[model samples]
Target: MRYYLNTQTDPAFNLAAEEYLLKSTNEDCCMLWRNHNTIVVGRNQNTLSQINPEFVQKHDIKVVRRITGGGAVYHDLGNINFTFIKVGEQTKKIDFSAYTRPILEYLNQVSVPARLDGRNDLTVDGLKISGNAQHIHKDRVLHHGTLLFDVNLEMLATVLLVNPEKYRDKAVQSIRSRVTNIRKYLLDHPTVEQFMEDLGRYMQKAYQAVLTRFSDDDLKQINDLAQKRYRQWDWNFGDSPAYDFSRSIRTPGGTIDIRMKVKEGTIQRIRIFGDFFGIDPVSDMEKRLTGCRHDHQSIKKILNAVDIERYIKDVTVDQLLHCMF
Candidate 1:
């Protein structure tokens, strides 16, 4: 097996690298990496429903969707991420234990008392320390997971917090879990970098893996992939499952209610209802929004170009955007 320590902190690049290594290469590989403040959603999840949009925007958190089936997860520099791509028999069944065993063993050797508690979670004293997911392509199985070395638990909770009542969809929802950082369980609290180094060294020795680096060609391809797909809003947010959204807000104008059906990230239908006074019919504004992308910037552009106050009295563009999103 080849071992790689990816030092890049960009979430999109890291995710794209995973795909490149899984599909573009045939070698059995293991990688240890990290990402900056970001939220990675599962492929089948509704991106809007899985994240706190206001908080994410305020903090400038990058949101990307991974090609895996599982719950959404938060990532930061303090966290450690691992990926294992192995070529296996096509008839082999998916096994969580097999992929997670090395992680559990590494944690136990370090006196963390970590154990595989459920299907795909690694827990320490009943609190989750890691969450894992997998993607299988033909004869190759890509298994990746996160290790909470010293992640910001507060930020993770705040960014992932969502109003469940706002969206009605069939998309898979993440199950919130009680989590703790591994640094807290260690006798001598080590920095996340040190922890990552120790873990990588252990894996190298355990598997007799060759430590390698990405060639310039490999990086160019990964960066190209990131720009083409991982950084695009269409793949990250537009690919979400179709859903119905409704939000009501009280403003200086009055109580405004916005309801819409979104498919392929485009608003297929929309209706605006409010007790505010207006000279023009609100139906006209709804018609303009029917074909717009269900995105903050897209809707804001349309709202700014029109005389929004004519349809909803005393409501500023920002206030109306709050209701629409």
Candidate 2:
């Protein structure tokens, strides 16, 4: 087994790095890295409905879609990310316990008392400290997880405060849990940087792993992968499957209700119903909104050409967009 040390803080690059290593390497390997403030959602998740879009945009948080099928997770420099990539038989690839056991052993050695609990998570005393997910590609499997050391739990709570009633989809929904940081339980209270170093060094010996650096070609491959897939808005947000969205808002003129059916990230059909007074027929506006992305900018662009006062007497584009989202 070998260990790849990645110090880059870009979430896209880090995620792409894992995929590149998974496909290129023949040896059983582990990747230890951290990312800047990011929200990584599962491949099968409805990213739009799983996050606070306003908060995410205001705070400049990078949202990346990972290859695994699991709930969305918040990542920051205070957290540690680990990946175990191995080429093995199909039977052993889906064993979550087999992959998480090493992590539990490490936490025990450090006297953290963390254990592999229900499904795929590491909990300290009952509060979750880690979330794990996996993806199988042909004959290989990639198992990865996040360990919260001193993550900004306050911001995490705020950013993840998404209203579940807005959209209905078949996508995997994230289960909220009582989460805590490793620093609170550790007696020494080591910095995240120090903990990452110590963990990497320990894994090298415990697994008889060779510590290797990425070559220039290897980095180029990772960068290309990041650019093409990890950093794309389409992959991160637009990949969500078809869903029904219904939201209502009170405006200065009156109340507005928007019911939209979105498929492939674009509104396939829309029906606007409300007590708002409009000189023009609401059906025309719904037609305009049809085929547009269910996004602020996309909706705003279509509304830009319409005479604002004609649709809703006093409602502005921003107000309508806010209500729909």
Candidate 3:
């Protein structure tokens, strides 16, 4: 029922903070705040398939994974990330809506006029402003969410998974149009710092406890854990069970078909059957992908950074990526 507040904005430190809280003492819960521009992928999501590789690389953005189940999201200095850690005891049941109530109340105090729209999303005027996910271990439950306040919507659009026709058809409105931010409703009345202070006060009031500050020892312990597990290829990309996936890609070289079986998020099997002429040794190309992380960034990094020129000629990395994913 206690709270631990982290004001650090570094993605690695923020991630570490969460892991530290999760594994430390279980009963005393804590809430941490992260303010920065970063992209966080879910535990089971494919980093490459879920993100725009070129855009992320060009912007020098850092990518990290959370120990939760959900889609990817973009966080920046304009956004606020919160993590609520509590031991789930029989006396105090863990209710998703109950936990989110405080957030709704806080937003209302700020005149954002937002409401929970779905099981895990908060929307204003029918556009989503926050998304949340959860992780449970033993008697502890961690529910974390992001609050979008004037975040860079353009960067969000660029880095997140592009809305395909199939996904759009599932909803009454397009997914892109259904998401919005508090800035759209703020009218430049409150600055970011004021809002953050107000939010901190609101949380302190809601929890009825003085904020607990984490120390360097706390951050270092958490960072070490996050780096080993959350940022690793096996955990982030290989978390998913083996599945067969096939995609058609268009490249400057030509159209190609990529089919592969992913096991534990790694490329266990693959075949590149395409019309594009092989300017290099295709066998070596297939070998390159095998045992590599099935996620886009890992695969692209291996393909682009490797000295593949010895085997292939006049073939760009994009063409290779187009053929694989």
Candidate 4:
């Protein structure tokens, strides 16, 4: 028998749900729900290459890589995320079309007017509103998708760069045309909670399985899984692709040049130098930064733990941090 779980928006929780479903041995299927206000890239994507580092640093946003295969996507509270999991039978090849058919059927029943276009997108009219990806385990398959309802379109485009101008000028179309929000078309689309309720009811009817809330045991298991893997740097960013990153930031003090070679989202090497002044020891900061996970908070925390005046001669903490990323 399958189960249905309504999860929270925290990336930690959604990732835990993915882990649980893929690890389960029973031949069952389920739906995992969540929403996020961040950027999520596929497992195979190069984090440094897929995103605009300057934009992300300016906005104080997060970027995480999921254990799935697909292009990058932006998620906000206005979006709805769904994950469908099923343990496949070894005797037969997995039929992705058959698995996603119920989703198309449910949307039609709800008057949402959606169609499965190409391999994994749900489109209405000619615009894409949903992008989905899959990850298969030993015998389990997980299909997760982002449902754009009222997501901030401008923010999405600004954060996810189609291609850096320094790269090939392949005549890239703007992301605005690539993704559309359901609120643009649905006059009375309900809130995420209400939509989830309706979706659960509809899915129960479609799959002919009782919709049961997650139990105490299930919640505990998911929580443990999240702490052990999902929230860890090793799984979220450390496995992303390697790339060279170079960015410049102008602080109140002066301009700083930040160059880094990142492998799997980990800071393999970093060199920070600029016209700004700092009191902390350059050697100490460089050593601390080289092996740490490439995250804003983590880097800041490491800097805080050290004596600021030993290396930098006169730069303020804020100025130094502005240049770190």
- Return the top candidate by lDDT: 1
Clashing pairs in 4: 277-315, 278-312, 278-313, 279-309, 279-311, 279-312, 279-313, 280-311, 280-312, 281-311
For each candidate, give its TM-score against the true structure.
Answer: 0.98, 0.97, 0.82, 0.78
Please identify model 3 stretches exceeding 4 Å from their true place.
Answer: 91-94, 163-177, 245-254, 276-281, 295-314
Whole-model Cα lDDT of every candidate shown, in order:
0.93, 0.89, 0.70, 0.70
Superior candidate under TM-score, 1 versus 2? 1
- What's the lDDT for residue 151 in model 4? 83
Give the range where candidate 1 is weakest over 10 consecutive residues by summed lDDT: 87-96
Report RMSD (Å) for each prediction in the order shown: 0.9, 1.3, 4.2, 4.6
Cα lDDT tens digits for candidate 1, 1-325: 9998799999999999999999977778999999999999999999999999878999999999999989999999989999999976474566788889999999999898999988899999899999999998989999999999999999999999998999999999999999999999999999999999999999999999999999999999999999999999999999999999999999999999999999989999999887998989999999999999999999999999999778888999999888866
> Residue 147's C-alpha lDDT in candidate 4?
76
Best by TM-score: 1
- Candidate 3, residue 302: Cα displacement in angstroms equals 6.7
| Candidate 4, residue 126: how far the Cα is off, in Å | 2.5
TM-score of 3: 0.82
- What tens-digit string does per-residue lDDT give for candidate 4 at 60-123? 6666667777777888887777767776655334355766677778777767789988877889
Q: Candidate 2 lDDT, tens digit per residue, 225-275?
A: 999999887888789878998989999979988888998888999988888
The pairs that clash in candidate 3 are 16-222, 36-76, 37-76, 48-296, 238-264, 238-265
